[model samples]
Target chain A: GAGVSQSPSNKVTEKGKDVELRCDPISGHTALYWYRQSLGQGLEFLIYFQGNSAPDKSGLPSDRFSAERTGGSVSTLTIQRTQQEDSAVYLCASSPGINYGYTFGSGTRLTVV
Target chain B: SQELEQSPQSLIVQEGKNLTINCTSSKTLYGLYWYKQKYGEGLIFLMMLQKGGEEKSHEKITAKLDEKKQQSSLHITASQPSHAGIYLCGAVGSNYKLTFGKGTLLTVNP
Candidate 1:
């Protein structure tokens, strides 16, 4: 079985630019999540989508961060006007639902200079 | 404020030794998940605990959830060099999001 997949394994961009990271969740997985892992830091929750609904968007760091899941399959996390602080590994994960284990993608490492 | 706190920040052990890592939460946890990540890679789910006093084991790894509902521990028996990586504990609340600990960097020496 194919696991979750993310695009552009690594991205380097200048400050003030925008980057879009894409995630393709496993088939039939209705719950998708995006998280950021800073160097030597924990995984920070960004946004989550469950069947076209995001009940919790509170974890998004700021207005510059936004994510959308289309057709309950693919998800895109966009970071607007990127800063050095946003230079981290962006991770995507999908689960069957509550109590199910989540399968994560290899992640897109974003380096802002 | 961080909802979950993992201790020891790091650990180093010889191959075939035993090691334990702990995760404590400021709030009650509805579910606890353990994951391992190799350098420059995504996390791989190890185990999940949903109820207090729950215990689950996978191969050489075992996990226990306290009845108090705020703590969990992951124990590795007969550690191998392949276990060298970052161990993270994630706690889920009523919300859908998962709050992760800072992770324990484990270095298993062969």
Candidate 2:
């Protein structure tokens, strides 16, 4: 893991409590992504795995937002009952397929007060 | 549903002056990404245009991809101040998911 690796970079939950964000990609890099950046908004496409397929949640913006990618390389993004617009910053990217080009991490700044 | 449109949303150059950022897409673009952010963190992979008039550079930043691929452009020749920040444009959807464009805030007033 020389790149993509996210964790609790900064979090201050409160609203409803329930926040778990983690992503460790770049190992074999099969493709995994989850994004959200509210403050001024822009990158918002939360959910997409590529190895075993079946994960393109369309862009989960509801259902309390959820994500998972186990045996393929570690990934989790759960935002159960957090509101306050759900704070911001929460990105994680990894790709080594589909043409290749993606390796982002250093995110997870959710602050719901 | 791959829509990306980024234009002069913010810019204020001066140090060596030379800027140009634009990313337009309404479809067509199996791959086209260029990102740079330093405001809150995350994202820093610049360059990736798929075929059709593709172009890439990574020293003074230079990207272009238009020929019906919807459009893409990001040029920063002499600009300094570390080239400011916030500049995004990603498009590669339909299954691989990757749709962005709402960034373009570079200020290098040195």
Off by over 4 Å in 2: A1-11, A14-16, A19-54, A57-88, A91-109, B1-14, B17-29, B36-38, B41-50, B55-62, B65-74, B78-83, B86-94, B99-109
Model 2 chain A: worst 10 consecutive residues (lDDT sum): A50-59
The candidate that achieves the highest lDDT relative to the unseen native structure? 1
Model 1 CAPRI quality: high
Q: TM-score per model for chain B alone?
A: 0.97, 0.33
So what's the TM-score on candidate 1?
0.95
Residue by residue across B1-110, what tens digits does model 2's lDDT show?
Answer: 87889999889989998889998898899899998999988989888899889888989989999889888899999899988989999988766778888999999998
- In model 2, pairs of residues that clash are none
Per-residue lDDT for B86 in model 1?
96
User: Clashing pairs in model 1?
Assistant: none
Best by TM-score: 1
Clashes per candidate (backbone, < 3 Å): 0, 0
Q: Every model's DockQ, to 2 decimals? A: 0.85, 0.31
TM-score of chain A of each: 0.97, 0.32
Cα distance off (Å), candidate 1, residue A96: 1.3
